[model samples]
Target chain A: MIECNNLTFSYRKATPILKEFNLTLENGGIYGLLGKNGAGKSTLLYLMCGLLTPAAGEVLVNGVNVRRRLPSTLRDIFLVPEEFDLPSITLEDYCRINAPFYPDFSMEALKRNLETFEMPEKIHLGYLSMGQKKKAYMCFALACNTPILIMDEPTNGLDITSKVQFRRFLAAQMNENRIILISTHQVHDVELLLDHIVIVDNRQLLLNRKTSEITSRLRFFNTLGAPDTDDPRLLYSARGVGGFANIARREDPLDEETDLNLESLYELCCRNPKLVENIFNPDNTSEHEQLG
Target chain B: MNNLDNFDKFSFSRFMMLAKREIISSKNIFLMELAVVAGLIIIAEFFISWSALPSLNDVKEYPSCYYSDSTCVSIIFVLGIWGFAFLANIAASLVCLKLSNKKGRITTFMTVGTQGEKYLLNFLIYDVFFVLYFFTVWLLVDLVRVIYVDMVYPFEGKWVLFYAIDQWNWMVALGTIALFLFSQAFYTLVSAFSPKLAFLKAFGLSYAVGFLLIPYSFFCSVVLIDKSFSGESNVIVIMASSVMIIYAIAMQLLAYYRYKETDII
Candidate 1:
């Protein structure tokens, strides 16, 4: 489990990346961290990994402050960065050198993953293609078997076949002991697998809710005729092929079930931040039920 | 594998892994350079020994000892030592620059460990390794030349190895220390500004510092031009190198503090 309280970070004195950010993540589910470019998703990931200490807030992982960076504290977190340097050695040599770092590092698991991807064993990692390198890194991250895994844009450069392979790998590897956080602009790629959604934007956490609750309480629909304009419960709207419509409260007489598009959900949540804020607020328990 | 292990615990181990990975991967290129230096030392020893011998028949005033009438051996030795320092510094600086920019510019600080610690450790280890390789190769070449000269016509007063060590060891030691110190300071300042500009800036800054130091060295030489100034000048150089080491440590600490406070990633 990861808990962040009032986290604030700034690159410069005046330009803050995260502001009073608070989040709670439970174990055993994939979380889709959604944001536009420069929305601080990667910053939050770094904080969790103790790569960047929070300026004011505290990030606790399994009850220990991450900034303390104690050996015990680091064993549980792994971050596969969007950009990383692959060591110049062969894959085998790289594994040998790193295996000692993680006490639980599994050579068997790492080799299995490589076999799954059909990566050559003896070749220097520096010579591998970009996708192959990413595969090697991903395999290493998982082979470390940390409880908290953070991936920033893991799917950005993958081909179609690699994407499927990646998804299958994650699905097979995930367990109740693990908490996987994936931050990507490719929401559709992970929508079917994510159990929770966390949206960050405008220096705040706009929403954090279970995917099931989002699908249950709100119904996403398209409209052709007069759209419902005066409904206070309507969260966000965008122009469709016919007219403007949105994710609105499921009213029996007027609302109907349509497929929930995560891309649309991300767009709507970002467009009407205040409405989404109000809906996900813990204080608005009664309002949360109104959607149900 | 217990899932609850702390991730930061892995930083040092990971850092070593990364460093070793880089070293092994580049070993071929590094070895090639090392071979070139080794070959140069042997060739230099042969030529300098030929001119140093008292045998008038073997004396040469051309490439072997252009300053054969003066202190040709010492001058050649000093120049060789300076070349060694430059090579070591460049190698050390380039590695740190590469590591600093490992993840794109903004993301470098996001690597698993303390940036300053990793940077210093990497530079120190590589510099030490290179210096050892340099001295060992030079020692062997000098030893061979001394044995050859002793076989042909023995010198009256000097043991070649001891003379070489007495004259060259201090410079090599000081030069290693200087290279390590300057590499850290230069790379730290460059990396602090921007990764894209780090290597270029470091190169320019180090060169400028070297250029500035030339006049400084000349000034010191002029002050100590007396025949009895050898011991005093050597001590001063050692002290200056010590200061450089401390400066490197200070700069490394500053870079760490900067990283601890900044939120570039």
Candidate 2:
């Protein structure tokens, strides 16, 4: 379990990036962290991983403060940043150095991930291109089998086929005991893999919900032409080349979950923050105020 | 495990793994250091000792080794260069740890292993490995020079050959050890504070930081030339050694503290 209580952080004397932020994530789910360019998503991720020191409060992973960075905690937690460097050594050498740190690390898993990513097992890390390097790194990260894995922009440089391979490889690594959090702006690439969605901006959490809970409460779909004026449940709409993408409230509990369109969902949350919060939290029934 | 009071953050097995990582990761750096050390020695031996080459004209040729005219056994100036070369190599090699001032590289290193383990591993790599590698290269290069010098000058005492271990003077060794420790600490201090353009910054900062070594130059003049040279009282030598070693250790501790405070921005 990962828990953040009253977490506050800032760079220099600028306005606090994250202030009095509180969040909790349980084991056994892939969490997609969504936010705008300067929305503090990466800062939150860094705080959780103990890479950045928080000004106040603490991030606890499995009941231990991450700030301490104990080996027991470090061994069980692996972070793959958006851009990273691999030592100038062969893949075999890389594994030899890094694998021993994580007791659960499996060579077979590495080989399987490598194959899934369509990469050769025997390789020089320094020689691979950026996309190939990300693949190789992601492959190794999954192989570590850490209880908690955090990746920032994992698919940013990947090609279409490699992105598909990455999703497959990541899904294969999912287990009940592990928690995965991926921070990215490229929502479409990881939209299918996410079990939960978290959106943050201006030090506020606009939405955080399980996919099931979100789908059960809200319906997302695209309609031809502009949205229907007669529909009372339509919450948000975006004009696209094909048609209008829309998100609507699902009043009936039995309503089938519609496929989530991440772009539209993101637009809705950004434009109608109060409404998004009100929909998720029933106690806050104050009429939704659309932010201009 | 939550209490962390008895938690063994430093595992011998884990440190060994980190050490292995350091060796493999910095092989290129070590090679570069080797090249530098070898090159300096060649310059010290051949280029500086160009008295062998008859001057083409009456005009005097400028000397590269201004300080004591560096030879294989000449002290101070050559040792300073070696220290600088070693510092440059280590700083350049640890580009993964914010040495290159890159966010991704630093985050990669900061996320792995325990803090203590990482510090210890870096300590070994920065200090111990440098000493061993430098000494090995020094010995081999000196041996080659000794052979070449012997061939050119067949007379018994024409040239001062490389001194064997048994012939080493305790006073000179003490001074050398102190200088080496100071070098290690200086590198750590400069590296911890200044990561980008570190080598140039370190050399520039060396002058302001030279109170630690200015006295040693005087000590070197008295004892460096003659291995058997001794003094009436060892107070000056002992004092300089004590000051240098204490400063070295203090700088090391400060560097470690800076390391602990590292935040991967």
Candidate 3:
């Protein structure tokens, strides 16, 4: 299990990035960390990876402090950053050096993953293209088989075919021993794979819910005309091709058949910051519990 | 299981891998070594040639062949060039140390087995390579001198040749050891910090030290060389060189011990 208790982090003293953040993630589930460009998504990921030091509170992975950088702790966690430079060496040579770090590392699996990603085995890492290098690193990380894997925009540079292949690979690879957290702006690509959705805005966790519960409770309905503007739960009303009334089902629904489009829900959540904060506040755990 | 700490499993090979990476990836180091070696050879040749120029008082004397001058020039040239091998070894140690620093101690601590021990071992290995290279250069120079000179100077005093070889050999050996030991300390200091900034930091500090100490210490030895050639043996100069070497080794070990307990950033 990964736990963050009252985690307050900032690059500088005054500019607070993450404030009094508390989050818990169990093993096996795929978590999608969604936020805007400067909403601290990457910073949160880096904090979890132990890449950046936390100002207050602690990030404990299976009772081990990440700050210590213990080998066992590191062996259990793998952070795939968006921008990383692999050392200039052949795939074989790179594997020979890094593979031994993780006890569960499988050379055979790494080789197979490389083939799956359509990366050549013999070429030096420096010779590989940017997309290919990312794939190679991803392949190696997957084969490392760490229990906690944090990937920052894993699908950023992937081609159409590779992206599809990557999704399939991820689905096939995921297991109960692993907890994967992916931070990305491309929600559609990861929406199907993620078991849970987490949104960050206004320096706090605005929403954190299981996909099944969220989809069931929140109905995203389209209307030809604008609904009563005074409705307290009317989170957002986007004027689409028809009219305004892009409603988020925060309270009891009028009818049962309507389904919530996650993209539309995300859009609604971002537009009105107060509604999201009010709905998912720590004080109202009972509401979230009811959804569970 | 009892023998192994958590780090032991990964630390050994990771450091070795990084060391190999450092050596192979850096071409600038080799170029620097070559440049220094070549420069030393040229400088030594110039000085030897200048010293051999005949004075006005020896105008009527039997013309001595410039063969002795050539021998002296060649010996000094070889010695100067060979000195760079030791300096190059120092360069390798510094590079490895710097690279380790930039990568961060976490990399060494988590991935490599025995971070401290592996650091020391890799540095020593780098030092050994340069030391052996210096020895090889010396042997090659000796071979060329013996083979090329015998045909020209048909019969010369073997004692003179032996004396010249003995005097130069100690200087070469001492120079090699002194630099190697100095590099060990430098590597520790650099590795204690991160390799990325470590080079600049090490260079900056060393340069500072050189500016402060070189004029007084380095020049003092140069002055002693002249005095020794007069009537005095210059025992103080020999003692100072010996003391400098011992101090270098002690300083390196002290740095290594300090690094062992300190928190790595």
Candidate 4:
């Protein structure tokens, strides 16, 4: 379990990027962290991994203060950043030098991941292209088998085929005892793999819910032209392609089962945050009738 | 079952692993540096032999024994080795200490081991390992020079290896040790603080500190210590050694603190 208790952090004396931000993550499931460009998604990941010191409060991983960076805590956590440079050494040599640090590192898993990603068995990491390097690094990271794994923009440089392969590889790697938190703007790449969705905007968590709960509470559907529903169940709607409106409505007894569209939901939440909160939390129903 | 709770304060195995990783990453640069140093030693020896041998014949008034004593040649060889070794130490420190400056490398390093282990790894590579390598190169170069000179000149007296070490003064030995510590600590301090231009900053700081301390120490020894200690030269050595020791300790502490608190950004 990783918990951030009232974490506050910033660069130098500038305004705090994260202010009194509180979050708790448990083991199991893949979490999709969604946010705008400067919404502190990367900062949150850094804080969780103990890479940056928080100005206030603490981040505890499995009851260990990450700030101390004890070996016991460090050995169980791995982070793959968006932009990284590997040394000019063969992949085998790189693994030989680094794999011993993690006691649970698995060579079999490494081979399997490499094969899945279509990367060569023996090649200098520096000689590979950026996309290949990212794949290789992701493979290594998964092979480490740490309890907590954090990846920032893991699919940014992947080709179309490699992106599908990455999704399959990641899905196959997920376990009930492991916690994988991926922060990225490409929601579609990870939509099917995410068990939970977390959206942040302007230093606050806009929405945090399980995918099942999100799909159960709201119904998403398509309509011709604009949504002209006179029923008081509409929450948010946005114009879609071919003169159709992508609509999200409160799930009623007569409503049919509809799959949640993460991209459209993300856009609606960004535009109508208060409605999202009211829809998820039934206690705040005073202004719940408002529609967009 | 709870492996997380089994946290060792200091793990020698982990430290060794980190050291091995550092050596592997830097092996290529190490080999290139060795080659460059060897080339420089050969060129320097060539110039020394060419310049001094011709001068010896030009001044015929001096006795032949003075030219063939081997003491002058040995001193020059030792001084040359010390100069090159010092340069190598500074260069190695600059390169090795900045390994964690880059964003990706820092993240990887922090994840692999404890900060204490990382700090010790830097010390091992930059100070201990480089010093050993420098001496090894120095010994090999001196051996080759001695053999080449013996074959060419057939000197009357025996040429001893490390002739100065045979009649070593305790004061000089202590001073040398203190100087070595001071130089290593100063380089580490500059490297920890100025990772981007560590070599340039360290070089400038070394000269600035040397100029200030050397003049002050000379003035104090001549004016005050000479009068108080009744012409005892060891007093100056004692004072200089004490200052260097304190400076070394202070700089080392500062460097360690800076390294511990350094943020990747």
Each model's backbone clash number: 11, 0, 11, 0
Best candidate, TM-score-wise? Answer: 4
| Candidate 4 structure quality by residue, lDDT tens digits, B1-265 | 2354555366687788888887887678777867776676667656765655534445445335332455555545445546643664466356335545556445644556777787777667756776676667756665665666555455533333455555345665666667667767777777777766776677677677684246334433332222223236677777877898899899888887877777666
Chain A alone, TM-score for each of the models? 0.85, 0.96, 0.84, 0.93
Q: What is the DockQ of candidate 3?
A: 0.21
Candidate 2 lDDT tens digits, B241-265:
8888999889878877777777776
lDDT of 4 at B207: 70
Report the candidate with higher lDDT, 1 versus 3: 1
Ranking, DockQ, top scorer first: 4, 2, 1, 3
Selected candidate, larger TM-score, 2 vs 4: 4
Report RMSD for candidate 4: 4.5
- Best of the candidates, DockQ: 4
Query: Candidate 3 — which residues are off by over 4 angstroms?
Result: A12-14, A221-234, A239-247, A250-265, A271-274, A277-292, B1-125, B128-265
> Order the candidates by TM-score, highest first — what do you get?
4, 2, 1, 3
**Which ten contiguous residues of candidate 3 chain A have the minimum total lDDT?**
A283-292
**For every candidate, what is the interface RMSD in angstroms?**
4.6, 2.6, 4.6, 2.0
Q: How many clashing residue pairs, candidate 4?
A: 0
Q: On residues A194-227, what C-alpha lDDT tens digit does candidate 2 reach at each position?
A: 9999988645687778888888889998888898
Off by over 4 Å in 4: A243-245, A284-292, B1-8, B54-71, B77-85, B88-105, B155-160, B209-231
Error of 4 at B128 (Å): 2.3
Docking class of 1: acceptable
